[model samples]
Target: MNRVVVVGASAGGLSAAEALRRAGHEGTITLVGDEPQTPYDRPPLSKQLLGGDWEPDRLALRSGPDLDALALELRLGVPATALDPAARSVTLADGVRLEYDALVVATGVRARRLPGTDGVAGVHTLRTLQDALALRARLRAGRRLVVVGGGFLGTEVAAVARGLGVEVTLVEPAPVPLAPAIGEQAGRFLTRLHQENGVRVRVETAVGEVLSAEGAVTGVRLTDASVLPADEVLVAIGCVPNTEWLADSGLTVRDGLFCDEYCGAAPGVYGVGDVARWYNPLFGTDMRVEHRTNASEQAMAVARTLVGPGERRPFAPVPYFWSDQYGTRFQAYGHLRGHDEARVLDSDFAGRRLLVAYRTGDRIAGVLAAGVAPRPLRALRALVAARTPWEAALADPNAG
Candidate 1:
């Protein structure tokens, strides 16, 4: 490929651009970003940044000299408006069209917002740096904050607000937080974690509407007709992949940009990170991972495929993700979602330590642990990566 155009300026996009240079792609590299600022780490936006523990500058993925070393043509503040795969051209919002021999779609995803929340002050979604700053400004010692959605993002924000002395009320539509993703046992543990940290946990209820006054959020009305008066509200329901630009680009755009095992969407076009729901050979399924680790790893895989001197290799990886709440960390390896069975391998509720293994059919599909030693967790991760049989994994002495 003589020229490469990578759309999106987030972790995955930046990684792909850097990896291309590292892989000896001495061609024209254009990194297009919708946001004006240079790429910044996103995981910290919800934790350290929103908690006022870290400044914006700390989130920078690369410094001036570091980014300069890559010799990238940075195109910031202009969003890709459309894509023409046959022409191999990307049209930006500024009317600038970039043509490339190879293209990488890494636009990632945008946080889903609650209906009728537009233009409402005191309402927030933690997706970007600016979103974190705005929400941080409203989080005060005596402020009341209601968090809709008890997923990883919502729970983390609730924990941070509680630590800042903000009264937090967490509402979830599930019987327990993270039950659908992680099993009910593990989800209940997280529920206790939030409740113990002074967060009011409301389960099995959805938000009817966001109440507003004078063009600002005053509270939220729940499906039960109950109102939660709050100084701030964060809707951490979920995210939607940024695939609108590729609507008519002749690529399969289902939940995300559909890709093959090699991460190829079209002939010379590939997708990575949250925007790509590619097939994973490891688990024999298709998944789009939104974790920080997967972004860099998958981008590196695509880089190899793009500038390879040999045959193309499939981008297969054992997906991993973690969440930090109230000084405790929860880590999971492999595919935890859609597991048929979940068994608690180890537990110490009073000590706040637990290890759970999720099984899909007869194989150990995933593992989740908190307060467990790193050594044992690594061993469990190996089992999941190897797709160990359910009974065999349980028989192993180090399984716990």
Candidate 2:
């Protein structure tokens, strides 16, 4: 490819550009980002930045000299407005048209917000650096905060807020937080962890509306008509892929941009990161992982596919993710979603440690561990990678 245009300036897009250079691509690369800031790590936004432990400068993914060495044409703060697959060109909001021989769509996702809460003070969504800074400014000791989702984001924020001496109330629409993503047992464990840290846990409830007065949020009303008085509200229900710019691009776009086993959306066009819902041959399904590691790993894979001399190989990988709450660390390997069974291989609730294995049919689909040593967790991850049979995995002494 003579020219490469990468849409998105975050982890995935920046990784792609860096990998292309490392792979000896001497052609032109144009990186487009809606945010004006240089590429920064996002995982810290919820934990360190929100908790007042880290500043925005500390989130930089690369130093000034390092980024400058890439020789990239950086277009920051201007979002892409449209894409023309036939013309192989992208139109930016600033009316700049960029042509490319290859394209990488890594626009990623945006935090989902509650309805009718726009322009309301004391309401927030933690997706961007600015979002974290704004929310952090509002957090302080004795402040009452209400979090509207039980996913990883909401839970982590709750943990950090609690550490800041803030009173936190977590509201979940499910029977338990993260029961659908993880398992009910693990979810319950997390719920108890939050409670032990002095957070009020509310399950099987939905926020009916954000109660506001004079354009300032006062509290939230639950579906049952119960009101949660709060100084601030964080809506972390989910995220929406940044695909609106590709509406007329003739590429398949639904919940995410559809791609093949090679991450190809069309000849000379590919999708990466959170914006990609690509077929994974290892799992025999199509999925879009929003994890930090996946973004960088997939970007390197796509880079090799683009610049490699040989035939492209199928992009199949054992998915992995992790979360930190209170003082415990939770990590998982392989695909845990849709597993029919989960077996607690080990437990020590008092010590805050556990290892669980998830099964689909006769094979081990995933493994999760909390507060486990790195060496043991690595061994467990291997079992999931091998697709070990359910009984065989249980029989193996080192499986956990």
Which pairs clash (backbone N, Cα, C closer than 3 Å) in model 1?
none
Tens-place lDDT digits, model 2, residues 221-300 = 99989999999999999999999999988899979999999999987888989999999988788989999898888889
TM-score of each candidate structure, all chains considered together:
0.99, 0.98
After superposition, candidate 2 runs with Cα above 4 Å error: 309-311
Model 2 TM-score (2 dp) = 0.98
Candidate 1 least-lDDT 10 residues: 309-318
- Scored by lDDT, model 1 comes in at 0.92
